[model samples]
Target: MLRKIIHIDMDAFYASIEQRDNPEYRGKPVAVGYGGKRGVVAAASYEARQYGVHSAMASVTALRKCPHLIFVMPRFEVYKTVSNQIMQIFREYTDKVEPLSLDEAFLDVTENKKVMEFATQIAKEIKQKIHCQTRLTASAGVSYNKFLAKIASDYNKPNGLYVITPEKAEKFLEKLGIEKFFGVGRVTAHRMHELGIRNGFDLKQHSEKELVHHFGKAGALYHQFARGIDEREVESEYVRKSLGAEETFAEDLHELVDLLRALDDIAREVHRRAEKRGFLAKTVTLKIKYADFAVVTRSRTVVNYLRTYDQLFDIGKELLLQVDDIEERKIRLMGLTLKNAGTDQVVLTNQPLQLTLEFKE
Candidate 1:
């Protein structure tokens, strides 16, 4: 059956909120961060991004790029309030709403309440209503499936909406770069590039078995993704997946004993956080970062929920043996993660009928 999925992403979410609240910040290169020597940018305004300032970039570096950049510390509480407001807006039209973060979500409106004949009209209405309620801008993308919907949302950005029909899906993916494919991060991108795969078209050149041989389990996903096909459902109801902690060390620790100490700390931290949040997971993932900033991760699925410190540490220790460069290269960071396979509760609310908060000047 043809599905109607819409991906909505806010434009410069944190930065835009700051701009909206502070008149002086308008049209300026504003950033949200600690703004200290050791600080990094949590988010950058459109103006700041123009200066090459981006999220997670060191604040000192962002300042070098734009000497006049203004930093505003993150108000996560405020952001959460805004997120709740937006989620309310999404629930008005459909019960199937999946929030990716504070700024993005997917809506399975195939069986929506409004009975709207076209998803484009629904997208337009949602955009309009968001503006009405929040005085913020949002973009929407409509497609037959989740993958295409996400790509379509990015088709036009910052208050723009784009739709991709089934007929247009193949052509749409054809033009996309490998970097744009979901889950294809830096390391994967590099691997694909080495294999002469630069975009969706190039990826289609390889068969499923061939991709699997090279990339393990992720290759089967590659073959389908290359063909612009994703069978995953629009999961509006999702459980909290992974909860973990990581730290970037200022100096690389070359000693195995030192790395283990750091790993123990990270594991303890993850265990504490998970216990506090009541997060239960059957899988544990250990991530390592080398002095060169290169990263590797090893994960194992256990039969029981990872709640105790011993389990976290033991799995992490076992995985450490797989790394050959622990003593040769400096270990910059280590982390532990726990992933939940399922969830039980779903949030339901009203979807916005329009997109503007008020009339524009």
Candidate 2:
């Protein structure tokens, strides 16, 4: 029997929450983040998005796009509370709910507690509950698999609902842009374009062998995606792969002293969060972005879980020095992350590690 999957995505999660709680922010362009020289936009309201402001954009850049954009500092604790409320609503329908983030999740409602005959109805009810309970809107997509369900959810916008039935999945995917396929980033899209692959239909023309040869193992997945095939299940057991924090500097740093100081601050925050979550890991990764926007990363693994702030900072400093010409290159951003090193979570060889980065804007 085909599965019934529903993907629910909250509309403009952070920014929407702010607007819902603050009547004055409603219908106005609002951005959630610090409006400082070193700040990044964590989330942008739909109004702000109309002006090209988006999440992960520099605060200055967002301001330049929309000078009247209202900046609000993120209240993470409040967001978490709302997220929990939403998750509870998901649990009311099915235990097979896989959360991609606090704002979005995938639900396997084929055997839901409510025993709903149609996943679309489940999605509609869930969306209604969320809005009624939280005073916020959510968009939902329903399909027989995770891929189509996720894509359907995004096909429409805030407060929208869409369904991609099995009958039309292939034709729908054929017309979809190549860039819309999951795991295809800007770099991958450029490579696919060079090979004359611009849409799902062009992608279907290539054999699995040819695609695998061109894009490695991920190419095989792309071949399946073009045919509207995704066998991945909704993994309800949330296993966090990695956690990290990053900060961009107001000005580039070339001095070793300043770099180390920045690393120290970031490490301290990472340790605090890890300690709070009881996330013990044995690997440390350091990411650096140069002034020219080039990025590089270094990682060190140990046998024991890193338990202290000093341990995190010490490893971070070591990784910092490992970077080439640490003192000569101007660095724009730095990040530190901790991974399980295959100790805490079951390692899936076929899956890539997902790192969640909390930007300190």
Candidate 3:
């Protein structure tokens, strides 16, 4: 039997919530984040996207793109509340729901509580309930597997629904751009271009052995994706691997005092989040990105779990001091992370939906 999957992606989740709550923001270009010189955009409304304003872009750059863009500080607590409401609605249909983030999730409705015969109907109902209850719209994609379902959801825009049946999956994939394939980032896509792989048809021309030699293990997955084959299941039990935060400075820092001060702030924020999430780990890692974009990291694994803010900060300070030529090189960004002593589980941070799903799968 084919597995029924539906991928639900909220349209500009943070920006939409703001618009739904505040009448003044509706139909205007809005970005959710600080507008300071050092600020980065967390989310951008579709209107703002038209002007090339997007999340992770510098606030200064976003403003340059859309001079009238409005900036609003993030309200995570309120977003979480709305997310819970959405998750409860998913539970109403199926227990096999895998949340990719606060905004999107994947539901295995093959054996749903509603005993729905068609996956498209389930996706339609879910989208309706979300809009009716929260006054925010969602786009849904339905198919036999997670990959097609995820791509289907994004096929349509806000308040849209799309389905990729088994019969159509092959032709649809053949015409799909190489960039749309799973695990294909900018760098990988560039390499594929050099090899003349522009679309799924081009990728299909390569044998698994040749692809594996080019992309290592990931090449094998690409070979499968070209054929519209994704065997991964919708995982409901997600274990967070690490917790941390990073900040990019508008101005580079070369002084030891400034670097230490920045590390202290990052350590404090990481500790606060860890405490809030009850995430405990024995290893602390410090990351440094130089003004020239060169990156380096230092880590230390202690016998005892880092439980106190002081402990996390002290370890972070030690790691920072251990970096090579820290005082000589100008630093553009600093980050702190906590993880288990000897595990290599992938970490899921707030990245683009494509990048996040790459790690989740």
Candidate 4:
């Protein structure tokens, strides 16, 4: 069967929430994060992007780009609520939904409730429902597989939909930027460029063996991606990959004592979530944003899954201390998430779809 996959991503998730709640923020440049000396933009409205502001970028740089940028501290509780709303909408169609983050997810609808002939219609309906229910716009991608669906979703911005068919897949990928390829990060893109592999076409020139020799396990995946082939099954269930909490203070934190307390709070929250979910996370990750806007994460994966609050907090504390510029940097937010060892959910669907009656056990 030709698998039907759709990728849905909310447009400017955090910033959209801000715009939704505050009518004044509409059509204006707004950023979600502290605009302090050590601050970073957690999310930027479309207007802010026009001024060169972006998420994960330093507030200082964003300010330099747009002095009039309006900054609002993040309200994670609200974001989580919105996320739940969208997730519920997704479940109405298919059980095979894989969430990429709070605002993005992939749905496999080959066998769905609507059982619609065309995935495009399903995508359209989902988008419409989101707008009707949440008053927010979402971009959607419809294609045969995951990678292409994801690419299609980003093809249009703000509020858009794009579809890639099998025949058009190769051509569409050829024009994609190296940075746009899945799993190709800043470091990987640079290395690919150094090897004269700039785009999908360039990536196709190398043999699987050559790529494996050069890039290890990722090389094999890239070899297939170059040809628009992704055989990865859509996992219906997945263990909690990370457990962490974060807070954006109303006031910027500039002292070590205060920072420790925040970190402790976040770590405890992470530990609690992990314990509740029975997560086997070996890696403890700490993410921080300075008032100056520079954001960084330090993580150390232990041999065993960390379950206790003490273990998680101790590692997080060590990581916090490693940031030598902490005192000089005014912190606006701190986040901790646990990365569990790899595990995939097993689905049960191969059984016959017929009804059976039994008289005796």
Candidate 1, residues 1-361, lDDT tens digits: the string is 7889999999898899999999999999999977776566878998998989998898889999999999998777788788889888888888888777788899999989889878889999999998998899998989888888898888788799998898877877777999999889999999999999998989999999999999999999989987878878877655565667776655678888888888887887778776766677888877887867699999888876666899889999998878776688878677777775445322223322111010101
Q: Tell me the lDDT of candidate 4.
A: 0.83
> After superposition, which runs of candidate 1 have C-alpha atoms over 4 Å from their true positions?
247-272, 282-336, 339-361
Per-prediction count of colliding residue pairs? 17, 0, 0, 14
Q: Per-residue alpha-carbon lDDT of model 3 for 142-180, expressed as tens digits?
A: 999888898899888878899999999999999999998
Tell how far residue 200 is off in model 3, in angstroms.
0.8
* Better structure of 1 and 3 per lDDT: 3
> What would you estimate as the lDDT of candidate 3?
0.86
lDDT of each: 0.81, 0.88, 0.86, 0.83
- Sorting all predicted structures by lDDT, with the top scorer first, yields 2, 3, 4, 1
lDDT of 2 by residue, 311-334 (tens): 999999999999999989899999
* Order of candidate numbers by TM-score, starting with the best: 2, 3, 4, 1
lDDT of 2: 0.88
lDDT of 4 by residue, 179-213 (tens): 89999999999999999989998998899999999
